[model samples]
Target: MVDPSPESVELARFSLWRSKLDCAFGWFEDAERTIESLLSPQAQNQPETLPFMIFIEPHLPRMEGLELLHLLRSHPSTQALPVVMFATSYDETDAARSRAAGASDYIVKPVDAREFMQVVSDTVARWLPVGSKKAD
Candidate 1:
């Protein structure tokens, strides 16, 4: 997860935990740090350590999510990873741009807490490997 909002990150973390998904999660408040972490020599040396999926918000303080998505798509290590771009509200142009930039999905964040959590859980579940078991 690469959301700048602490609330958003906490919500996502709680949602994943409550869903009982056995997965590791990392959060980045800015795109530059995320880029550095992902494109570092250590990361390049061990591509397998890269994340299976990434959830990013469209608007960020430094580099925008779309720009970050483009960079990720161009990189060999993260090109194939599923990228989900989310926003507080739906915008046709943003959705189209995200798809063109190789985002796996685009979602409008729900204002309702429960609905938001459900969306997060469903999205994560959809991307999980087949036959994946819930955390005990």
Candidate 2:
């Protein structure tokens, strides 16, 4: 769930809708916005009540985004969260850099529905905690 601009939000939203896997996705234009919402009590309740996988797009400008990712991966609470990056091309050096930072996976954008669903299914299968399950 990596999206920084409104256009990115739209793209991710569309990709998510087209996915055949049962999952949950949320977006924020910036890191601070995502943090604020995620820190709230409502967000805390989500893990227990809804029991869905989370995909976050901190979407900070390159440097800032990297900083945010570092912070998240270093922080005790979110360090092991199942995060991934998405972009126009998987060839970008920066995407690899992001993986080095902490992303569990990365996806190339303009994803066809089939490939997109495959990625979603694969991520869920790999990341969802043992004994916990998603309805889809």
Give the best candidate by lDDT.
Answer: 1
RMSD versus native structure for model 2:
4.2
lDDT of 1 at 32: 92
**Leading candidate by TM-score:** 1
Summarize candidate 2's per-residue lDDT along 17-134 as a digit string, tens digits.
Answer: 5643445666666677655565456765565433234444434564355666776677555676767665555556767778899877766644575565556556666776676554
Tell me the lDDT of candidate 2: 0.59
**RMSD after CA superposition, every candidate:** 1.1, 4.2
For 21-100, candidate 1 gives per-residue lDDT tens digits of 87888999989989999988888998877888999899988789999999999999999899999798899999999999
Using all chains and alpha carbons, the TM-scores for the candidates as numbered come to 0.95, 0.62
Q: In candidate 2, residue 73 scores what lDDT?
A: 74
* Pairs in steric clash, model 1: none
Clash count in backbone of candidate 2: 1
